[model samples]
Target: MLCTDCLALRDQVAIYENELDMLHEEHQTQQLTDIQQLKGVKNPRRSGTGQLGSLRADRHVFISDSGAKGTIESLVEPSDGVATVTVEFPTPDVTPTILGIKEYYCQLEESLQFEFKATSAVSLGDHKVAELAKGPKVAVTDASKVTDVGELKNLIAELQRELADLEKCGEELEVEIEERKEVYLEEIAELQVRRPCGDSQSPPAIGWTCVCSCVTLCCVEELENAQADLDTQMKEQCADYDELLSEKMALDIEIAAYRDLVELEEDRLCYL
Candidate 1:
């Protein structure tokens, strides 16, 4: 987070971190340690930020006079309610296709694009960012200044590192999700076609199918193999995401300490 991807988290990192702290503090004794010890992602003993609960995707951090709580909530509210999936093209000129899930869990009444810019406004893609960039590079960022010239420079540098990381993670996750979706879809088709005919055979159980283990597998063996792969992938993602959460927790403490340090230094400078 310190090196890469914090920039994408720009506005909402504080709210998520703060709420996590709130939940942790609420638990009092060994709850925090319990969370730390859990090797699996599905632990119900811990609080739900609901996949994200409080954590917003793609944060970009800055020092602002406005408190972190309100600032984060304002920034993420629009984007949080909607889950958007977009397919990217290798060609830079072409825009990616925005996709809808086969099963949507929510009912939303809102805009065409689910994402937003840092301003808490309805901002669009790279074109708008490019146009904004045509002005002074620091123009937008300068508005949120809560630090001296040196600190602002450091913040900008940190944000840039985060942006690169965010892009990398986003691309990786997209590729994986799409690949799994395609594999499952193909298996479904094959299984339906190859399904046993007549009253001689009984249909397979819902969870255990020839086409998809979680869905329908072309072969029962194939289902087991696919599920094994999925299990491995899930374990890997859980580990990675757990690492991220750990980092976030550590960062939450560090940032608070940094704030204290900055304030103390400010006071010492004033004394001089």
Candidate 2:
């Protein structure tokens, strides 16, 4: 027969175990949802795979601004919702150039001209990062992929480096976008203020109003289109960031489990 204190401790332990089980179930469900999202079910922006959907290494691209032709060396996905493409030109004298993903269009015969360009958008916040850290473990790297613990550690280190780069890129892009937006906004305001008022003596005020209205309509349409494109790009970047974060979290969990297994094996050996 257990004492009252002993019975109380047992009850507490049972309750704790039940709570843990519920948490585990919730985690599994979240993982399923995340996997489905990564598969592009929830994100219509994700098309194809491998870095911004078809912007993979070795793809030929043309820099529209400079008219320089080159093969894609790599695509750096931005944290601030922009994509940067590194291109290697055939001319040895010409150093490999990095351009905004929008600056270049894919030259693939099957691929349509990609109109999407990276713009300034929301920055991934610390709170969001913390929330993602609690998400279910995703199997980013298979256990069989690494033959030894050393190899696994190396892979994790590489991933950490990539994650750091992405975070830095996001910060820089955010600042740049804000500055560009401000400058453009100022210019637009100045243009509006400087517009010549229709002279009552020459052109009728009504005719001037009509001309101004047409110009305003065109400008409004252009701005609307630009804003829509920016929103789409932002969504795409957020999805990419989430997918990468999930992968990193999964790898971290895998390493932790591996360590636990090793420790358990060591304890069994000691008892033997």
Candidate 3:
């Protein structure tokens, strides 16, 4: 008793439902892959060759606050996160200066209490000792005086603004994804309701079944094309979302580093 157009609409709905299920499965697999990739990535800040990695014994460096040239005697990391660095000056009468490193690095100009400039050689050894004894000491730049507090504040503020912007973009993308899903669902529902058989109550005319079959075939082809386009778009959106998340993670690390630097600077100023 079913008309040709009604049967075609039923077939279209089944095909669409199957494609929707496949798309959902594909999206879940893609999400799992993205998560695995994220886990495999290593944070660059904690790497061996990072800024803090250069701290070692016998390295020639000059204190930024005090223009005192010295050699690192030892670097120790205790149970506490803060590290301790012992620097030995050439004068036998002068005692070694013990510095606390709260995630501190020598080369950064932002360092308030201490800044270390590492020489290429591990130990200048006796040559540096002899040179120090000769009394024409190596010139040490007062990096603390050159550091601009205002500039650091501005940099931190800029980084915070960028982080906020990225967060907003991520939220927008999520909303967009939801909106696209709703739109696709609405379109599918509309297609079902607009079927020729659903609108017309009268009996079929001569050769009407043939015309309905041709129309149904065309609709099915269009539906397949639309599904393909939707799948491609969803994949692209997911990729973009993943990329944004990675960038957000990097920004979070960078923001933490800058905050640490600011805190260290403030601590130094409090003691002064």
Candidate 4:
């Protein structure tokens, strides 16, 4: 239906359109590549000196993605809009621990406190028991000539009063310790607000030095007074505890001796 020249022109036109379509697709591909490269690029804002502060081009930037590890060799943007991303092929395979470092430290601190309290209590109890043993032996020797039930009853009542006083002293010391911790924590919180991230010269920072120091000193003085009070109370209570223990040992000996005398008297009557 067509001549040879016409058919040849049609063939040339079809080839040209195919080549243009191919060029358009190649251009689209190049654009997409450029876009992807720009996605990861970042511009470091210049500081007052026209130089980037705290932005080191050679600093190693750690990157982990999809089990792949990499280091950013340089963050400088190039003329052709491509970033030099240096990446190592394989990453170290370290198993994760059940507890993080912060949690582990917290748990460790708690355990140490528990251990300290438990050890101190046990040692004090053992020492007191040893002292009581010595007291009872001495009391037995002294009780050979004493035999008064009324006197023993009075000694028992006095020991109970001393125990109650010691318990009250211990309770007061515990309350003071709690209060000291609270005041210290409050001071720490105030310090944190005054200087966040350890930057003392931060903008808009209020001058809190005078007031904070006064408050802190007051708290420290209170803590010191409480500690002195606790020391005095402990000394007084320990002395009282020792004296009461000795008296209790003597009372117990007197009671036992009296019981033996009564039994002996009863046996003599039965013989009659």
Candidate 5:
């Protein structure tokens, strides 16, 4: 019933629609591929440094330049395959516990103690390093030779300020930990008073037991979270400290070079 020109135009329109659908499908597929590629780039499984990937949990991972094996305690993977791995080695003073405690309260206490020790050690080490570096202040014999002596002084002053800030942060962290410990102790004592035993069918008593368990779990998790935060803080502080040390060494070298230049200038002026 349709004219030849009309039928031909209808077929052409259908072909164009099919082509568009195919193009759309291809576009969607390409978009998906791009998304996957971006994710892979963000969280690379294999190290760009040519480190081999392993699926075995017990396999030793090398973390240092010397290729020393460290037992991977845990791996936190916030993004797909990429992880922040915590590697630990067996030491005489501190050994990782292979077996976990069944009791919730005991586990919480143990976690708290472990975090406390780690935080203490890092703080103490930082303090000692800071003290050692502070001594024998950079004495510029010919301060006039260094044109940017004021800048160098400012840099050193900034380092001192950073150290003070770090000390303050550590004190704050300790105070927070102490406060948390007190709160935990109070909760534990309250739980002890309300400790339910013997098969009680009462709904209220059962609910109370659940609450105690939840509280215990929350305490344990909170301590773990605090430990993680402390670890992050320690890394940041260490980086800052290293930067300060590097700057100090560079400044010392620059000062020495300038002093030599000044001496050369003096000799030339005397000759003239």
Candidate 6:
């Protein structure tokens, strides 16, 4: 087919894609609003009833019974004189969300067909803050033996070191994200320049097969260029929007990771 026809067809396709993208984005905004509400839910449990709500403090058992009835005072060791007895906390079934926050965002995105190809990069960073976080990595911090000035000083020093390191890492990530954004903007500009067409470009100045009057041809050419320019701008703007959306998702994942860390620390506490 002629370039004229091909260009027209491409323009038509661009128009359809633009409309599709707009509707998809609107729908996604609405979905995000709903998810935000769910995330902010003050309490998932009823005020009076106890039907497994998140607000209720779970059972914290202080006794264990492997061979005898579970009680606060039960022999946890064998009758043999050589073995010493140990008291264990009662275990309560704690079920975490089978899906991580990042996964939840992904699932939410997938539920919408229009945002089909939203594959964002994933990042896993190590802050080694488990000690300061009172996580499983540093159970020694939980010991009650450290009461002297020297012991307390050492623990405080360790905690301060870990906190400073974590803060430094966070600053580094912020710098990295800023650099990434600079690169992203440059790429978007390049794409705009090379994109197929834009709104500034208009239809052909002449007829499909024949050259019309100079004035008429020029007029048509002006409109065609205007349309092309507009199209390019629209596409580039959409690209930037999508990138920002992905960045937002990445941030939410970090927040969720912190929440998970909290839950993990609580697990260790229950053990203690």
Candidate 2 has which clashing residue pairs, if any? none
Count residue pairs with overlapping backbones in model 2: 0
**TM-score, per-candidate, Cα-based:** 0.25, 0.29, 0.26, 0.29, 0.36, 0.28
Against the true structure, what is every candidate's RMSD? 35.3, 36.2, 36.2, 44.9, 37.3, 31.8
How do these models rank on TM-score, best leading?
5, 4, 2, 6, 3, 1
What is the Å distance of residue 110 in model 2 from its true position? 34
Please give the CA lDDT of all the candidate structures: 0.37, 0.43, 0.41, 0.47, 0.48, 0.41
Assess the local accuracy of residue 205 in candidate 2 as a C-alpha lDDT between 0 and 100: 46
How do the residues 1-272 of candidate 2 rate in per-residue lDDT, one tens digit apiece?
Answer: 11232344345445644654565466556645643443332222463464343322224555534443433344433333343444343311111221211122112111211211121244544532111221222224542334455665666665565555445544554565566666656655665565566665345545555565666556655545444444444444455555445445544654564465456435433422
Candidate 5 residue-wise lDDT, 1-272, digit = tens: 11232344345445644654565466556645744443444333676677644432223544544332333344435334454443344211101111111132244345545644674587444432122121222222232233364765765566566556656665665676678768767876786667566676456666776786687678767655654554455565556556445545645654564465456435433422
Residue 73 miss distance in model 1 (angstroms): 71
lDDT of 3 by residue, 132-173 (tens): 111222232222232344544454454445445444544554
Model 1 segments more than 4 A misplaced:
1-145, 205-272
Question: What's the C-alpha lDDT at position 265 in model 1?
Answer: 38
lDDT of candidate 6 over 1-272, digit per residue (tens) = 12233344345445644654565466556545754554444433343565534321122234334322122222222222231222333333222332243355444444432342332233434523222121122222531233344555565556555445544544554565466556655654564455455454423312311332344446545544443443443343344445444434544554575577467547634543
Count residue pairs with overlapping backbones in model 3: 0
State residue 39's C-alpha deviation in candidate 3, in Å.
62
lDDT of 4 by residue, 1-272 (tens): 11232344345445644654565466556645654564556566576679743322333545455443433344344434354444322332121211232243344346545644664586443323122211121121232133465655565565556556555665665676678668767776777576744466653344465566667678667656655554554564555446445545645643564465456435433422
TM-score of 1: 0.25
Mark the 10 consecutive residues where model 3 has the least summed lDDT: 91-100
The candidate that wins on TM-score is: 5
Better of 2 and 4 by TM-score: 4
In candidate 6 the C-alpha lDDT for residue 38 amounts to 41
The TM-score that candidate 5 achieves is: 0.36
lDDT of 3 at 78: 29
Which residue runs does candidate 2 get wrong by more than 4 Å?
1-205
